[model samples]
Target: DMTQAASTGGMMEMPRASRGQAHLKLAEFAAKQLRGETRVASFSLNGWDTHSRQKRNLGAALERLSGCILALKQGVGPAVWDKTAVVAMTEFGRTVRENGTGGTDHGTGGTMVLAGGAIRGGRVYGRWPGLEEATLYNRRDLMPTGDVREVCAWIMRGITGTGISDLETKVFPGMQMAQDPGFLR
Candidate 1:
């Protein structure tokens, strides 16, 4: 469901209808490319940085993201969905409190979303570091409980059938990769 559009300088815009259509077209393209070949693929999206008046910006971004996800589910059908894995993430999170500009400042920690039938669906993964005054990092951001690399290693071994030896020493060095202790199973 990854789609590209003509960039309007730094302000690219695509109508919702067009975006949906692009999703369908891209799905068709992917299916054709993957015909009689591999079952695994990775995709990414960008432009999530919001520093001012983020409510609408965030909602719109998430809406488009969700739409792409649903489109993929429909595009691949049930069998593919059973083996598919979708992981979405941001490089960093922002301050818990809105800034003077109605957005947030750069801060540590954010969230990642995993989708697909291979994943344990309808469940929120990760430990919740409470937003209490002292719990916040630098008194402004959420604390990260899980090392993201551990999550990746777990995914590799459990989902892709990568050997533990490969995952630890070859794929992720100095990671001491452990079994996924979360809901990915």
Candidate 2:
């Protein structure tokens, strides 16, 4: 996809390729199986490395991301959309400090976004770690107090009826499941 094309074009043509192709491909695959209820779908679009021209790269990434979401919504029918859920995330985030070339370097603490009618929409979850001295990780990156494993546990229990004990003992050893508050509608 976009990454492939962008790479072939030496980085300038990445955003030129359509990001919505992934969603369309998924719909095609689902249709072949005659599936009635598709529960989940995940996708990732890269090119966030803004070593130069940060604004342009960010804009293109946002546009492509938006297109992908819209296409996915249209591909999946309304009935399924009402029950389905989409969760997007990145491995990590970049540093707060802009580099000399108006770019960002690898850092800690990325963001996760959830979308769909099943989600409570119009609400941002998670605690915001204020950007300040003594708050950064190793005095350079954002501190991650929230363990992602706990979030995964909640989703497994609530969505698929996985037992908390099993998740704690098997999936993530020694993880204490806390109150997830039913993120799904």
By lDDT, the best candidate is 1
65-126 in candidate 2: lDDT tens per residue? 66666666666657666765566666777777778888778888767767766677788778
Q: Identify the runs in model 2 with alpha carbons over 4 angstroms from their true place.
A: 1-38
In angstroms, give how far residue 88 of model 1 lies from its true place. Answer: 1.1
* Tens-digit lDDT track of model 1 for 46-148: 4477788788678867876787777777767787778777777777888898888788878787888888777877877777989997999889998877767
Clashing pairs in 1: none
